[model samples]
Target: MPTTAAESQFDELGSLYEDVVDWPFRRDIELPAVLHSLGDLTRSDVLDFGCGAGLYTRLLAGQGARRVVGYDESEGMLREARHREAKEQRGIEYVSQLTPALAHRFDVVLSVYVLPYVASRDGLRQMCASMARMLRPGGRLLALPLHPDYDPHSDYYTAYGFRLVSESPHVEGSPVRLELRVRGVEADVTAYYWSRGALEEALHGAGFGPVFWAAPWPPGLARIEDAPTVQRAYLRRPHAAMLDCRLARAAE
Candidate 1:
């Protein structure tokens, strides 16, 4: 049977997880520095939104997050996350919904490279709004998304004329890599690419302010390795609204 749109998306994501799992940690990099600067995770409630394979959730728990929740839309990914949790004996919870049931606000929320798949403007807005509401006042949200400027579909030897320059703007023309398995079944994946302005506008429209942006080169790994072209955005929620009331107001 063919994969559903949701399944196809995750099938691609699962293929890329292997590359990311050994990254930063395997190379001893400073990828977490910018996020940690936003807030102290020690004994703080944290949620790893779209926490594929629960790698970052484990990281946060190991770093002493009071509670770490991992939520994703992929069952295969969640199964792997649960297996890892059991093997590591970690206390992170994995849910298969975009927004799981949580009564109270969290101290910090972080999402790594999961926003672009959110192709719908309304859905994306709802996600941002949900994240903001999931936080306590002054809580922070740090997310990384694909650089909007990078084109992922255009082939290298296209109709347009090509010339040599001092340097190339990309490692791989397409930052995302799609891998298929033995039976021609697609499996793992990784994605990176985003523009600064588009990200800012998205967050601002979502009601988040005081954004901090950074493009830190891979701390210990070669820049060309893994097509290291990621952008990080740090946004803090100065205030939060009641979920029902916010929706009601928006509907007014």
Candidate 2:
């Protein structure tokens, strides 16, 4: 993977990266949505793209995945992941990039909060193609990227410890920079934007079928009338969007 400004930013984050994504919104809402989309993992071969700190990779291993390999471009992030793997002995494999030998080897390829780091449409297309190649026939790709409808200016929920310093017009392929504060440390992060149409086209071009958008709130949310006010508010304006896709059965 080519080095980008975002990759360098993540490298600097390193071990501190875990704290940035440890908010309740991720644990209570985003993770559940991802797991729901994943359905079952028993004996499945899984690939975690951009698997920072091996958080989800370890989780998938715990869920009975037969084989789990995590790939990330940032060495600093991988260092943290390696540290945890050595300590926990979860049998997870971490690599910097996918090699050609591993093509079509995974039953499921999951990426979370990674697509926005792609700085160009061509980069996103290549990413989709690589993800497609990673999956076997009928394999699924579950991705969670920043929502196209996200309003950097909104104050609906501000407890996540980040603020938008500046934003470009919400046009396709624009850039958005954010100022993040975690554990009394501050940093600037940059991410690119993709309209729904742009993302759909990239997926389809890479041999993925129609993309399905999953709701932020799970089905069981309807039964919980006593849900916390913050939870309900977060659901109303989710910062992230779930994209569920699958490799075509006839894909080469």
Candidate 3:
């Protein structure tokens, strides 16, 4: 069995999960913010941890990353990625294992929206350790975890094409149900929420420090037809957050 159970939740999702990116919040804000945080990808070796249909894999390669690896445990999701690669022929590698040759290999590990799937502290630690191992010392890990401060009222983000139904009196490990109704694509998913302290501990335990969470910055309103209102509401308490940190050296 895998160390974490997240893959199970997404196994049947296949390519459907990839379509969520078209939602206004992700397209106008989340995607741009993350790509900007990466600075430049020119010839960078990147690992798309929990790649999920190679969305970032394709984007990273398009951004000039020399090589990109899409790693995920869901065979169904990998099937979708592989199928796309067969047609798109992007030269990206999709794998289910974190092999020895992959250790300390990537310059950046883009773990978009993966943290919320961890079911336990140990799973979170394992996920972080795996990400750290894939990253060279001083390489960056750009993780987009479900926002720790997401409005518990659930419907607070209806305008963003999704709603979060959190457990009442939620705490670390509580289930946060995610309902997606974006661009005519609908799906129901369950994710876990970890407190900020627990998240910090997991990252620290995995040899990542000085973690910085970024606020959602919508690059522009060009895409969203109704920008001002959605921007104000979503940015006020976004459903997901960006985290930037580096694998610390042994001495540091």
Candidate 4:
């Protein structure tokens, strides 16, 4: 698979990818919304794009998906995924990239926190097009990209153990770089800041329709009274947003 600068950063942080599971905001807020939006998977042939360490890939298979395949651009991450596959024998296939022959092979494509890494508008377009082509007609695409409204100036991210080392202008097409620390180890990550309008336009151009956004917190989890003051505040300002879309059906 072709490697990009963003993928290179992930490769460097390969060992820490799994640690993301412990991030409370992601574990408690973002991921639950993604899973809730998925609804059912028992009969679906699912594609887990950017399946770092095969976390969700394994979960999908365990959820009784008929078939599950994971694709990631990082060799280091794939190695970890493959190791888990070998030990667990979940019958999941891991690949560095989606092949042309796999076009329209999936009933659902799940990409979590992936698109922001795509540094250019053209790159995002190509990524969306590839995802559209991989799904059968009427297939669903569920993604969680960095929230377009995220404030780099706030201490909100600090609660999650991330600090903004530096950032480009908050203008469209610019990149926001952050430093994440866990157990005294730090990794620098970069992601492109894409406006919500641009993202929706790209999805529609790729033949997805009726796109909708879901808040980071699941239905019952956004209550301010149920959460700590900090968490309640954090819940109001999401770090990521859910994108739910479906491929257009062929005309009868």
TM-score of candidate 2 against the unseen true structure: 0.92
Ranking by lDDT: 3, 4, 2, 1
TM match of model 3 to true structure: 0.92
Q: What is the lDDT of candidate 1?
A: 0.52
Task: Provide C-alpha RMSD values for all models, in order.
Answer: 9.9, 2.0, 2.9, 2.3
lDDT of each structure? 0.52, 0.80, 0.83, 0.80
Pairwise TM-score winner, candidates 3 and 4: 4
Q: In candidate 4, which residue pairs clash? A: none
Question: How close is every model to the real structure, measured as TM-score?
Answer: 0.63, 0.92, 0.92, 0.92
Which of candidates 1 and 3 is the stronger one according to lDDT? 3
Q: Give candidate 3 regions above 4 Å deviation.
A: 183-185, 220-227, 250-252
Q: What is the alpha-carbon lDDT of model 3 when measured against the actual structure?
A: 0.83
Query: Candidate 4 lDDT, tens digit per residue, 168-207?
Result: 6457878778678777788888877888998998888889
Clashes of 2: 0
Model 1 Cα lDDT, one tens digit per residue, 1-252: 111124446734554564554433223333444344434577689878778777788888878888999978787778778888888888898876534356235777776656544534454556666666666666667775543433334332111111111123333222344333332333534332224555555566655675665443334334343443222211111000111111111110
Q: How much does candidate 4 score in TM-score?
A: 0.92
